[model samples]
Structure formats: structure tokens, C-alpha cells
Target: MLTARFKLDPEDRVVSFHLEGHAGDAVKGENIICAAASAIAQTAIGSLQDIARIEPDYQAEDGLICCRVSYDGDDQDQLIQIASLMGSVRIGCMQLEDSYGSHYITCIDES
Candidate 1:
């Protein structure tokens, strides 16, 4: 099974996320669920660093990715950009969960 954990701030913004594990529903290279989940998570983080120009604290390894984005209340534009990106990640993961069902994948949000 695959699991994603999202940590949210008081404003319900995604402050951080940890995604790991394989869906194990198929052979490793052929797991569509895993591929979709990984694409969503990686794209969001990549956008943060490359497009948004923010270097979030993060680490990555085989089947594992964990990241945290920092923001300032004074910079609404930056906050909005980051929030939007994070929201996309959350939305993507939830969509996968909805499609694949909890038996293969799980997404949890933490306050």
C-alpha cells in the first residue's frame, strides 16, 4: 500500500507533506497508481523550487519524499503561490485515493 500524510497550518495551508511506499497493486514498474501519485507529488515540489523559486526543506529517496515549505504572512503573493501548489498536491492525492480506493492507497491530513 501507499500512504501520503499532509500537515496543515491553522489556515489549512499545506505546510508539509510526506509521501512514501508503493501501491503494491502491480509489479513495481507497471504500477499506474504509484506512477500517478509520484507524478503529482514530484510536480508540486518541482514547481516550488524551479518555478516559484522557493527552496523548501526536503529530502528524497527511493519510494520516499518529504518536504516542508516556509512562508511569511506579509507576502501574500508568495503565500498564494505556495498555497495553490500545495493544494494541487493535496487534490491530486485525494483524487487518486478516490479512484483507487483505500485498499491500495491512503491519504491523511493532519492539523
Candidate 2:
């Protein structure tokens, strides 16, 4: 199980993220989500410096890519801005889990 940590300020619309495991590889349907997630964080923070790091993990799941992404920024609004484009996003399953005032977006499956 991979995990990500996102530290964000709801009022400021800024973001930073840390990805756990090995995330350098690109799966079939995860590119868009991964790119969108990265873009959102980049846009929210207005720079890539806030992106702490990324790690990837390998698992035995056929036709699916799973990973955790952590980020910090102003609010869900920024996230929603990217999420709203989900329809136009050609990618995998982006799942978000909320805990302890923080949110994590995980890719569950891919094509």
C-alpha cells in the first residue's frame, strides 16, 4: 500500500505534496491523473518547489496502477478545479481519501 501526504492551507490556495513509493514509471491510464495532480499542485503553489518528492511502488494488479499522492495548498476549490476536468481527463481511477484534515489522492486502477 502506497501513501502520500498533502499539506495545504484552505484559505490561501497553496499546495505542497509528497509521494511515497516509486512513482517514476507511467502506467497506461494513470498518466492524465498523475499529470493533473502534479499540475494542480504546481498551479496551487505557483511553483514546483512545494512538491517535496515522489516515490513509486510495484504491485501485482492487472490493468491497474495504484499510488498515493500528497499535496498541500489553499482549499478543495483548487483541487476541484482540476477534478472538474475529470470528464475530459483520459486516465485511470483517481480516488481521494480524507483524513485528519488532510487529503490523499490515490490511483486505484488503470486501463
Candidate 3:
């Protein structure tokens, strides 16, 4: 199963997110669950770096993706944009989890 963990800051903003493991719902190349998760994650990362211009630390590999947004006190606009992008990712993952409960799990941690 795929495990997706979203870590939030005191203000309830997602500071980091980690997605690992495969859905195992189908063969490696034909898993729609995995494909949906991957697309959401990659799109969010691209938006954060390209549109938001926020240089979040990130790593992507087969069946694994980890990203942590660095907070800049002086850049509230950029931070908000990043938050929106991450929110979209979270929503997509949540929908996947709801539809494929047995193949995907989502956890949120607040700190």
C-alpha cells in the first residue's frame, strides 16, 4: 500500500509531505493509483519551484517522494502560493485514499 504523510506547522500549513511505497493494486507500470499520486506530487513540486519560485527541498524516486518547504518570514505571498499548491496535492491524495482505501493511506501530523 502507498503511505502518504503530511506534516503541518503550528499555523496548520503543510511544511512537509512524504509519499512512499506502491499501491500494489496492479502491476508496477499499470497501477492507476500510483500514477495519480505521482502526477499530483510532481505537479505540486513543479508549481512550487516554477510558479511560486519557492525552492523547496525535494527528492523523488521510484515509489517515493519527499518534499519540505522552507519558510521565509519575508515572503508571505510566496508562502501562500506554496500552501495552495500543497493543498491541491493533499486533496488529490485524500480523494485517492477515499476511493482506494485498501491500497492507499493518508496521515496528517501537526506540530
Ranking the candidates on TM-score from highest down gives 1, 3, 2
Across 51-106, the per-residue lDDT of candidate 1 in tens digits comes to: 67788888778788888998765777777889999889889989999998988889
Q: How accurate is candidate 2 locally (lDDT)?
A: 0.33
TM-scores across all candidates? 0.93, 0.28, 0.91
Cα-based lDDT for every prediction: 0.88, 0.33, 0.84
Error of 2 at 82 (Å): 18
Candidate 3, residues 37-96, lDDT tens digits: the string is: 989999999999899987789999998998998666678788789889887877888889
lDDT, model 1, position 71? 74
For every model shown, the clashing-pair count is: 0, 20, 0
Worst-scoring 10-residue span by lDDT in model 2: 84-93
lDDT of 1: 0.88
Candidate 3 ranges beyond 4 A from true positions: none
Write the number of the candidate with greater TM-score, choosing between 1 and 2: 1
lDDT: the better of candidates 2 and 3: 3
Question: Candidate 2 — which residues are off by over 4 angstroms?
Answer: 8-16, 20-30, 47-111
Candidate 2 TM-score versus the reference: 0.28
- How close is each model in CA RMSD to the real structure? 1.2, 12.4, 1.4
